[model samples]
Target: MPIRYALPNDADAMAEITCAAFAEFEDFDVTREQSAANWRRNLLAEAAERPRPHHTRIAELPDGTVIGLVKGGPADPGLGLDAEILALAIHPDHQRHGHGRALLRTVAADLCADGFGSLAIRVLAVNERARRFYTSLGGVLAGEVPPGEVFYAWPELAALL
Candidate 1:
C-alpha cells in the first residue's frame, strides 16, 4: 500500500482502518462517541478551522482501499505546541511492512520542515508492541499517560545541530 496524506472524503475508510487496528490490540476500548468525534474533528474539518486534524494521512492500495491512517495535532490548547499521531491504524493484512514508520516519518518530516522543534505522539501503555514501535523510533514516555497504559511520543531528535 502507498502511504500518503489522507483526504477529507476518506473518513469512512479511515474509521474502518481504525476499528480494525484497535480491535486486534489489547488496549482501551475507545468509545463510539470518541471515534465519531474523531472522524468529524479530523477528517471533516478543513485546515483553516482545525490545523491538527488536517494533518492526517492515509495508506491505500492501488484499488483505492484505505488500509492505514494517521492523525496528529497540537499538543494542547494555546501553546503553539506540536504533537503527533493522535492515532495510526493499518489493516492487519498490511502490518509489518514499514508502512507505519513511513507514515510517521512523513508527518514528522513535515513538522520538522515547519520548524516544530519537537513532535509528540500517544500510544496505549499496555500495548507493548505499540510502545516498542514508538520507542524504537525514539519516542520518550511522559507522565503515566493515564488509563494505566498510555504513553506520549517525541519522535524528532532534540535540538538540531
Candidate 2:
C-alpha cells in the first residue's frame, strides 16, 4: 500500500472508507452523505489553515483505490502529547491488511519531522480491536473520557517510525 497526503478531491473516498469502517461498530452511527459533507467541510478548512497545522493522509493500492485514511493535528498539551490522531480508518474490506499501520506510520513520521515528539489518540472504549492495535504499536493507556472513549499515548513519536 502507498500512502500520500490527502487532497480535497479525496474527501469522498475518505468518507466512504470511514463510513464502511465504522459501520462495523454496532454503536457507530453516521450516514455516508453526512460523512462526505463533513470531510468536504474539514478539507476546505484544512486547506485554509496557513502552514497546515494538521495532517491527513490516504492509503491506496496501485490501482488507485483508496482503502484507508488518517487525520491528525496538534493535541491539547494537557493530554501529555504534542500531536493527536483525530481519525484513523480502513475500509472494512481492507482491514487487517496493514493499510492502517502504514497510514499511521506515515503520519507519525510526518509529525516527527515537524518536531512533534509525543502523540495520542482517543478510541471508542468499545472498539477492542482498535485498542489492541494501538497497544501493539506501543501506545500506553493514558486516560478516558466520559460516555465511552479512552486515550492512548506514545511518548516518543519516532518510536512509531
Candidate 3:
C-alpha cells in the first residue's frame, strides 16, 4: 500500500474506514457511548473545518482504493501529551499486513520530529487486540484516565516517542 496525506475527496472514504475500524465500538459501551450517526457527524464536522487536525493519513492500494488510514490528535480537556492516535484501521480485506505498522511508524516519527516529545493514545481497555498491538509498538499504559482517556503522562508526546 502507498501511504500519503489524505485529501478532501478522501473524506467519505475516511469516514467509512473510521466506521468500519470501530464497528465493534459503534454501540454504547461501559466506558463510553458512541453511535454510527454520531461518528459520521463528527467526521463530517472535522472534514468541514477550516483548520483541520493534521494527523490523519491514508493508505492507497494498487487498485486505487484507500484501504487503510491512521489519525491522531490530543485528548480533550487535554493532559498535554501533544499527540494521540485517534484512529487507525486497515480494511478487513487488507488487514494482517504491515500497513498498520507502517502508517503508525510514519505518524509517530512525524509527530516526534515536529517537536512533540511524547504522545498518548486511548484504546478501549476492552479492545485487547488493539491494546496488545500498541504495547508491542512500545507504548505502555501510563494509567487509565477513564471516559476515552488517551493513555500517557504529561509531555506525553515526548514520553511516548
Candidate 4:
C-alpha cells in the first residue's frame, strides 16, 4: 500500500472512501453532500496552511486507485485537541487488510516528526469495531467527549511505529 499526500484532484475519491466508511455513523450529523463539500474545502485549506498539508494522506493501490484515507494534524482548538486523528476511513472493500493500521502508523509518525507529544482520536462508544481498532494500535482511553464519544490517545509515537 503506497501512501501519499492527497492532491486537490483526489478529493472525489477521498470523499467516496470517507462517505462509504462512515455511512453507518448516523450520529455524525452530516449528510454525504455536506461531507463531500467539507472535504473539498478542507483539502484546499490544508494546502494553504504552513507545513504543507502533510496531515491528509491517501492510500492507493499499485494501479493508482485510492482505497483509503486518514486526515488529522496538530490539534484544532474547536475540537479541543493538541493533536488529533480527525478522520480515518478505508473503503468497505479494503477493510481488514492492514490499510487502517498503516494509516494510523503513518499519521502517528508524521505527528511525532511534527513535534506533537501525543495524538488523540474520538470513537463512538457503540462502535466496538472502531474502539477495538484504535486499542489494537495502542490508543489509550484518555477520556470521553460529549454526545457519547470516547477519546483515546497514543502518548508515544515510537511504539506505534
Best by TM-score: 2
Error of 2 at 13 (Å): 1.1
Query: Which model is ahead, 1 or 4, in terms of TM-score?
Result: 4
Model 3 clash pairs? 117-157, 117-158, 118-156, 118-157, 118-158, 118-159, 119-156, 119-157
Cα displacement (Å) at residue 31, model 1:
7.0
Q: Summarize candidate 1's per-residue lDDT along 50-110 as a digit string, tens digits.
A: 3333367777777788877776555653222465556777888888888888777766665
Question: How many clashes show up in model 1?
Answer: 3
Q: Write the per-residue lDDT of candidate 2 for residues 7-123, one digit (tens) a residue.
A: 435778888999888987777788888899989988998889987888888877767788888988899777878999999999888889788888899888878877899999999
Regarding lDDT, does 3 or 4 come out ahead? 4
Which parts of model 4 are misplaced by more than 4 Å? Answer: 1-8, 76-81
Location of the lowest summed lDDT over 10 successive residues in candidate 2: 1-10
lDDT per residue (tens digit) for residues 1-161 in model 4: 55453433567777788888877878766666777788889888887888753587778886778888888677655545468888889999999989888887887777778877767888888889999988888888888788789888876656778
> Model 1 lDDT vs. the true structure?
0.65
* Global lDDT scores for all candidate models: 0.65, 0.86, 0.63, 0.78
Cα deviation at 13, candidate 1, in Å, is 0.5
Best by lDDT: 2
For each candidate, C-alpha RMSD in Å? Answer: 3.7, 1.8, 4.6, 2.5
For residue 138, model 4's alpha carbon misses the true position, in angstroms, by 1.2
TM-score per candidate, in order? 0.78, 0.92, 0.70, 0.86
